[model samples]
Target: MSLGRYVGRRLAITVPVLVGVTALTFSFVHLLPGDAVDAIVGFRDVSAETEAAIRAEYHLDQPVWDQYLLWLRDAITLEFGESPVTGRDVSATIGRRLPATLALGGAAWLLALAIGIPAGIVTAVSAGKPADEVGRLAALAGIATPNFWLGLILLFVFSVRLGWFRVLPPDAPLVSLATVKFLVLPTITLGTAAAALVMRLLRSSMRRELDAPYVTAARARGLPERTVILKHVLRNAFLPVVTVAGLQLAFLVDGAVVVEGIFSWPGMGRLLVRSILRRDYPVIQAIVLVIGIAIVLANLLVDIIYAILDPRIRY
Candidate 1:
């Protein structure tokens, strides 16, 4: 199929997936222990009429199916209603916090690629040596470590003992050095596991490519070792790494929730945790829908990249 046709087909497939995400999110969020009204009036004595009015105002009094239909209708237009707890437009709130999350995720992604690709190349070239063994062990440890624990350890060591960075992230604009300084620990914490995964996969891919007949032909032609590896083996081995990096977007989102919370970063992940706790239905639903859309778009981008990298790949 043509690229346009393929993209259109994939996007069409996403529509129902998105709808299911909305329906499931709405149902599960409502099934939580308390409504927004209860969160708003917590531990306070209110008249029965006042409580009933609050429920009616927020449409919490509606049946679950009715609420889902109403929400789905507005959501189709990208009109997530106001947060019952904060009374702010859900889109505007998410817009404000989105940049921080993007910045964090982007930095972590770059760091992962920078570290992983080179490490993978080194390990593959030096297979069965001490360097490869050490790299493998380090990757295993990185994958095993928890994000929150790593964040705390980095915070304690760098921020508290060494005095290298702050315990809490600064309130600075995204482009500034202050923001970069603040992001260092959280980015490392969030990206380490992903980096490890990429390294292992790439190493394996490259090793397989190195043993291929074409690589043997290139070597027998008296090409330089560096040229044979870089110009031939690495290119073929890179496709799987691209696939993993695309899927890591979802992992980054999930890890950001804990990493942001640990560092007290004011991003959508932190907002999500807070909203869930307070039963902020609109905010919760909107954030989840946005995340779903992001994952779909990432997968689409991955498919496009696959075709670009390997012309043999078909729609």
Candidate 2:
């Protein structure tokens, strides 16, 4: 199929999936024990009338289906309503926090690519050698390590003992040097697993490509080893890596809650954790919807990239 038609088809499939996600998120969030009003008021006791008024105001007295319909309607127009906990607009809150998450995720993604691709290439080229063995071992360790534990270790060594970085992220603008300094440890902590995953996948891909008949054909044509690998093999090997990277990018965007909390980063992940704790329904629903959108779009982008990288791929 044509590129435009392919994208349209994917988007068509995505809309219903996102709607289902929203419905499920709304239902599941409401199903959690404890009322949002009680969470909002904390330990303080309020009058019965006041509690009723609060519930009426937020339509908490409505049926689950009613609330979901109301939310879905508002969401269509990009209106996410106010946070029950903070009384702030959900969209505004997300807007403020999203940049931080993007910065963190983007830096981590770049770091992963910088490390993973080259390491994968090296490991593949030197397969069965000590370097390959060491790379595999390190990748295994990276995959096994927990992000929160790694963040704490990095924070303790770099920020506590060495004083090279700060425990808490800075209040500086996202583009500033101070922000970049603060992001280093978090980036490394977040990116390590993704890098390891990419490395292993790419190494396997390249090894398979190396054994393909085309690699021998190129070599027989008097092409340099570097040319044969880079020009012919790596392109084919990179297709799976592209898919993994795209999915990882989506995961990084929404799944950095633990890392963000550990480092006190003011990102969407941190906001999500807070919203969940406080029973901020609107915020939680909005965040989940955003995550769903990200995942769908990331997959779409990956499909497009696949078609671009390997012309043999078709919709």
Candidate 3:
């Protein structure tokens, strides 16, 4: 089968999976115990007339299934309704906040690539040396430190005593891109574990590839050590690396919440978290659905990329 058909097949599977996710998310969020009006108003003395008006205003008196269909339809048209807390369009709120998350996620991805690949290569080459030990220790630290704890430590040390950066200076204007600077600490915190995982995966894969029959044959046939390692070993080794990286990106979406909150970086993770705390079903379901779709789409894209990278892969 061809790449096009393979991609189509992936999409065919992803669409229904996303629909199921959306439906489940909607149902469960609304199922959470409490009156939506009381949850929003925080008053025990809400009048029946006021409650009825609120229900009519948001069309909440409709059947749960009807409410879901209405919401799904509006979402398809990019409407997304208004936030109960802020009284702003949900889509608009997400639009305003998305760039902040992307900025952090992007920074984290670059940092992971920069630190991980070279460390993996060096560790693989150095096998049992001091460099390899250092690489192992770095990975250990990265793996052990939770993002929330790491962020707090960094904030305490760097922002508190050392005065390197402030604790997320009050929502700066979105135009200047200074938000990148604010998000740096959180990004590094978030990416540390990912970088470490990638390093280990690559290091192990590279070590195995270097010792494989083909590499041994190439070396026996007069290939330089450097050429054999770089040209032959690393290339084949990267197929697994690509898979790991794609999985890391998917994990990053949900995993970003702790870092997002610590840094006050506006993103879907933060939005979902806040919505859950407030029991805001619409916002929660919407964000969860978006995240689910994004992960499936990303995996599909990765598979397509794999085919493009090596045409030996067939549908």
Candidate 4:
């Protein structure tokens, strides 16, 4: 397919995926045993009229499919309804928290790329040497390190023992110089695993590309090592790297929940945890739908990047 046609096809595919996401989110939420209304009303004894009113208010009296349609309709317009726990609008709640998550995710992604790409290139260039072995060992450690544990260790070393950083800020400010400091540990926590994965992928891709006929021809023509690797090898090798980066960027949002919780950063992930704990169906559904849409869109974006990087790529 042509580039435009390929993009169009990808966008077309996204619609059903989003629909399926919404359907599944709604179904699974209702499937969970427990009354959200009961949680909302709390331990107070209530009359039957009040109970009926609460059900009607949330459209719980409607059929399952009907509730799904209502929720989905509001979600399409970005109106995700009120939170059962906080009585706040779900959309507003998400909007407030999303920027923090995005900022952290963006930082982690850039850090991963900055570290992973260079490490991968060096390992590929120095294959079978001590540098390669050391790189592989570090990557292995990074991949094996649990995010929460890494986060806690860093917290103890940096915040508790060294006094280099604060564990939690007294006042959470989204934009400030201190924000960078606030984000450092959490970013490292999330980025380490992603970086390892990217490094491994890039190293393999680079090694494979290095063995190609064009690379041998470039070397035979007396091209400088840097020129051969940068001008020829990296372009081809970057396709899979870009693919991994895009998918990981999507995952970073969800992954932020753990890091955010460990570090006490206010983000969508924390909100998600709270919503789930409270059985706030509307909030949970909205958060999940947003995440699902983000993943689908990220895949589409990767496809676009693929087409740009290699003109031969098609839908």
Q: Tens digit of lDDT per residue, candidate 3, span 160-202?
A: 8988777874467755556556666887887898899889999
Query: Which 10 successive residues of model 1 have the least lDDT summed?
Result: 247-256
- The residue ranges of model 4 lying beyond 4 angstroms of the native Cα positions read 34-48, 63-65, 170-172
Top candidate by TM-score: 4
- Summing lDDT over every window of 10 consecutive residues in candidate 4, give the lowest-scoring window: 169-178
- Residue runs of model 1 more than 4 Å from their true location after superposition: 1-5, 26-70
Clashes of each: 0, 0, 0, 0
Q: Write the per-residue lDDT of candidate 1 for residues 153-267, one digit (tens) a residue.
A: 9999998999999888777778889888989999999889888989999999999999999999998999999999998999899999998899877545533888888888888
**lDDT by residue for model 4 (84-164), tens:** 678898888888888888989999999999999999999999999999999999999999999999999999999999989
lDDT against true structure, model 4: 0.87
What is candidate 1's CA lDDT for residue 84?
68
lDDT of 2 by residue, 166-209 (tens): 88877788899998998999999999998999999999999999
Quote the lDDT for 268 in model 1: 85
- List the candidates' TM-scores in order: 0.83, 0.87, 0.84, 0.90
Candidate 4 residue pairs that clash: none
lDDT per model vs. reference: 0.84, 0.87, 0.79, 0.87
Better of 1 and 3 by TM-score: 3
Q: With candidate 3 superimposed using the best TM-score fit, by how many Å does residue 2's alpha carbon deviate from the native?
A: 2.9
Q: In model 2, what lDDT does residue 104 have?
A: 91
